[model samples]
Target chain A: MLKTRIIPCLDVIKNKVVKGVNFKNIKVMGNAVEMARYYSLSGADELCMLDINASYQNRKTFIKTVEAIAKVINIPLTVGGGISVLDDITDLLNAGADKVSINSAAVKNPKLIRQASIKHGSQCIVVAIDGKRHENKMKVVVKGGREITKKELIVWAKEVQSLGAGEILMTSMDTDGVQNGFDSSMLKKVTSNVSIPVIASGGVGNLEHFYLGHLTKSTGLLAASVFHSGKYKIKSVKKYLKNKGVPVRL
Target chain B: MKKKVIGLIDGQSGNIGSINKAIKEIIKGRPYQLKIIKGEFDNSLFSKIILPGQGAYATLISNLKKLKIYKPLKKYLDNNRSYLGICVGMQILSDQGHEDKTTKGLGIIAGEIKKFKSKKLIIPHMGWNSIRLNKEDPIITNNLDNKDFYFVHSYIFQNIKKSNVLANTHYGKKFPSIIKKGNIYGVQFHPEKSHKYGLNLIKNYILKS
Candidate 1:
């Protein structure tokens, strides 16, 4: 049977993990690879490392970071941020990333998503939709949520699926890191609309938030700060969800 | 004991990094040499040939035949050597594939690769899923029974021979996850990305098989 994936996300700034783990009990030093291995051993089904570097030169450094993480751990790694053209997808996938997450650049030119899924298989291409709500409407946001595009949420998601993207990583800027919960209704709208797998990201503050995020029927649940702060381990979270009747791998 | 050589057939377009790293890590301090077969490779140099694929089945059909990797690979398989196929590599053993288009597979196993048809389940079947062993092989099924391996694909073998299927996984229906006939072994999961269980599977395939 297929189980809900518990993904631990990391913010990579030029090959180093920032806003990372500070364990109060365990004496663990957090590097990109160490923290990645930490999460994998802690029972994270997959790991997503977003290159938060605003600088252009950090592209090379991010690839190195991806290679480093891939060498140590043996789980799927989805690298996001700054993926514009076909070559960006090639470089990251060659550097040992199982999947590449394209956000803003895919919206600017939707053909890149098609070209990518055609050249590389759709299994490796993940179209990340960052959405934000305004006046009873949820619009697609890009450029790290700085710029909101004219594309609506569900329409763009259906478009990417038709364009050959295998998965959708829906992150809502409004609830991101806010400790409230995920945009469950918005995620439900997108997840039910698309036939592909939808991963619910963004706001997941408490343990129940993860369960609520999964209740949206998103196959994968991704969280960052909660796991990084050592407040909740992936194992404990999976246990919580398992007891709640969620089929999680223990 | 003579040193054993493990040939990783790289079609050049496929992702062979994690597999290469896994082979290297597994054979550390052991009397084994890892050979990556990209263009031309000698047929007799390897004891085991592994085709670790990640892309679509159509691309596998094109790139494998286009590159110099085909003739030697066919020779290796025809000779009945220990061959392990991962994901697309495993799917290519079918007679035909319908992923991108109507493409032909190696036909080592009698089946047609088709997309999953279920309104209730998600496409791509991406996650950690368990394997149900049909006929246990000491090397392949060793320590891997009922353990969830990472699977990320949209296609599966529809009419695979029941006698050849070593293990099967369930989504909305039962599908072959591990198929083997003689020495040709194929698994429809990413062992290189499946952490310890995956690494152990690889090590067993390399050192023991």
Candidate 2:
């Protein structure tokens, strides 16, 4: 059986790992390659690096960072953050990323998901949805959570899956970087709405939230702050989840 | 000693960086040489062949055919020299694949790839999963027996011959994860991305197999 994946996400900006609250106030974490290597060796099932700022100058550095990380680590790498075109996806993959998650681009051009999946295969095209509860309904937000689209969370998620996306990376904006817990309710809703594997991102504080990650519909649980802050090692998290009857790779 | 040349078949559709980097790292200071076989490659030039692909079955087959390496690849593996396939690379070893439309595979291991039938689990069985060994090899030393490997695919080798089955991973059903017929070894998981155990498997194949 497939085990639940404990992924440590690193937000990248100018080729450095960073953290932000609600996708703002970015703070550098560390060297991208070093942290990525550490995470891979530390038993991270997969590593996600979002190029939080994918500018013209940052693109080269981001790709360079990806190449360096790929050279050092043997596990899978998923690179996101400001991926807007087919060429960008090509460059990232060519630079050694295993998968590329698209958010704003995918929302703006849903056909890009189909085209990308057709070109690179569905397995490599991960559609990342940033959901925020506006009023009473969860709506999709894009552009680093700066703009909220009219698309409802679940409907847009199902659309992407039908558009040939292999997986979904659901990040709740409200709870993101809060260190409270993963938005399990929203995660469960998204996971239930889609047939493809969903990765629960945004909020994860402790072991309970990690265990709750397994209980929810998500197959991959992503925690940024805990792993970035050095409060919890990925190995310990997996062990904890495994002890709690979650199928994890140890 | 003769130079052991390993050819990584690049059909222009699949990602080969991680695989390329992994093999390069393992074969450092060794007698092995890695070659990226893009278009037409002389099959005899390679002591071993590694084909790593992704995407739809039809697209992968089309890419292989477009590069004009499909026939030569099939011919090369028909007699079974040391070979390794990952994901779509493994799927293409089958006689046919039923993803999207019925398409032809290498017909090497005598099987057909089909999507998972059970709705209880996710379609693409992504993430790490442990395998159950069905057989062992004395010549080609791969310690893949019951070891966890990373897998991401919706299709499984369902109609595979029993003799060809080497390892099976249970998701909703007992599907063949590793299939070997003679010297050809095809794993549904990405050994290059499967961490330490996976790298060890590649190292074993390169040094021993």
Candidate 3:
């Protein structure tokens, strides 16, 4: 049987990790490579680096950060944020990233997903969906959850699968930064509908929240604040899940 | 005497960062030099060869051809020199691969790469899964028994001979996780990314063999 993966999602800006409350009120943790090295050596099965820097100069810094982290870390690294075209994906993969995540670009032009998966295998293409609750339905939101779309979350998840996405990184904008827990019901809906692995992101406050995240049928549990702020250690989370019979690597 | 160098072929196919780092870490105090083979490689300079790959099968072979190592690689395999193939490098050792389209492989072994067909499981079998060793090979299964190795792939070599399989792991059905024919070795899992269990395997390959 496959073990559950614990991933720490680092919001990187100018080669530094930044954690925000409800996607705002940003605070810097430390250097990106140092933080990533700590998590990888601890118990993180994989690490996700998202470039939150909006400026062009900062994006170059993010790529260099990825290269530096890859040199020290011996695990799979997934790089996301501002990946609009195939060349962007190529640049990251060439820089030692195992996978490149596409969010708004995949929604804006579905062909990019097809082109990326075709050029580089689908195993390296992860489609990230940022969704928010709207009137009893999970609506797909882009632009870092600032804008909502007519496309529903479940529908877009299935569409990405058809367009050749290896995995889906689903984040609940409503629960993000609140640190209560994952949106289990929404996660269950998407995980049950799609065949690809689903990584549940956004909310995780305690060890029990990670347990709940795995219980919802997600292959991975990704959190930002709990991991960044040093409240919950990755080893404890893996040990907790192993005790709960969740099949985690301890 | 010159140092016994291990040739690592990087055909500009995909990322070989972790693999390169792992090899460097393993050969720190050893009696071997790690050489990254980019363009043309003189086959006789190295005692062992390793091909680590990612991405599509067509792109990998195309890059190998573009680098003009296709013929030399085929010669290396034919001579039964110590060789190891990781991930897509393993898949390309068969007769053909059915990814995106049917791409011709090196034909160093007797098999065809087929996609894993399981209505129960996902396409790309990604994550850490335990392997059941069928038989013991010193380089491939040294100090490894019923241990999990990291895997991330969609297709696997189908209908391989029983003697060629060193280990197999189950997704929906059992597929070859490690395969060996003569001096040639192929592993479906990434030993570099798989922590201790994987590092031990690579160390055994370099030090023991």
Candidate 4:
């Protein structure tokens, strides 16, 4: 049986790991490589680094951060944010990122997903969708959940899969930063529609919430605030899932 | 005493940074240097070799041939001087690959690479899964029993000899996760990306003096 993965998402900005990662083991605190190493040792099945850095000059710096992290840790790294073109994906992969997640750019131009999948096998291409419930209908939103699109979550998910995306990163803006739980309903809708793996993100507050995400169709559970705030440890969540009869790599 | 150099073959199939990191971490204090084998490499230069590859089966095999390392790799494995293959690196060791079209492989093992069938099961059997040891091998799996390792592949070795398989993992049915024939070893999972358990496997391979 495939084990449920516990992923800790780190928000990377200009080579520093910012946004709510408060842990004692963070030796360098803001250092991306140190945080990545700490997460790998903390039993994180995988690490997702969203490069929030937006500058042409800082591109090399972000790649260097990826190189440093790849040198220290032995876990798969999924990088997202600012991936607009095929060259961006190629650059990140060359920098040692195991997988690259494409969000807004994918929605703006679905051809990028197909082109990327062809260039670098679909297994490394992740389509991240930010969905928010509006008028009792879940609509796909982009620009970090600031803008809403007319596309339905399920419809867009199926399209991405057809375009050759290997996995989907479904994040709920409404549940995000709330510390309640993941949008299990939305995740179920997307996962059911697509055969590829779905990673449930946003609003993972406690151990039970992590378990709840497992109960859904998602294969991986991703949370930032809960992990960065030190409210729960990665190992503890893995332990909880393991005890709850959810297959987890301990 | 001269330090042993471990050759990590890079066929330009994909990134090999993680594998390098794992080996470096394992052999920190030891008198061993990790050498990157980008193109044609002499078999006698290194004591052992680690082949890590990704992407399509035909592409990787063709890349090896294009780099003019095909003959050398075959000769090196024929000598049985401790070689480890990860993912497509392992798949290419078979007789042929059935991905897209039937492509010729190294024939190190008498088998064909196949994609997982079954409408119920996912195409690329991704994520962490546990392995059941078929037999004990100190270098292949070491003492790591009943532990799950990260797997991300669409195809697996089929019609393989029973004696050649070292461990089996199940997705829809039991498939070879680890295979060992004398000094030749191949793992379907990426030890470089498997975190601690993966690091352990790499350590076992490097420190198995």
User: Tens-digit lDDT track for model 3 on B127-172?
Assistant: 8888888888887556587787888988899979999999998888
List candidate 4 stretches off by more than 4 Å: A20-30, B140-142
TM (B chain), model 1: 0.94
| Model 2 residue A215 lDDT score | 84
Question: Residue A237 deviation, candidate 4, in Å?
Answer: 1.2
Candidate 1, superposed: residue stretches over 4 Å from native:
A20-30
TM-score for each model: 0.95, 0.97, 0.95, 0.94
- Judging by TM-score against the true structure, name the best candidate: 2
- Please give the lDDT score at residue A209 for candidate 2: 91
lDDT, candidate 3, at A68: 95
Write the residue-wise lDDT of candidate 3 on A33-108 in tens digits.
Answer: 9998898889788899998764788888888999999988877899999788788999999888999999998989
Clashing pairs in 3: none
> Candidate 1's residue-wise lDDT over A115-195, tens digit each?
998888888899999998866788998776778788899899999999999899999888886779998999999998999
Ranking by lDDT: 3, 2, 1, 4
User: Which RMSD values do the candidates have, in order?
Assistant: 3.1, 1.5, 1.7, 3.1
Clashes of each: 0, 0, 0, 0
Give a tens-digit lDDT track for model 2, residues B1-209: 77789999887766788888778988899988999998888888999998887777788888889999898898898877889888889888888998667998888888788889877788788999998888776422455577789998998887778898878899998998888888888888888899998888878777777
Q: How high is the DockQ of candidate 3?
A: 0.70
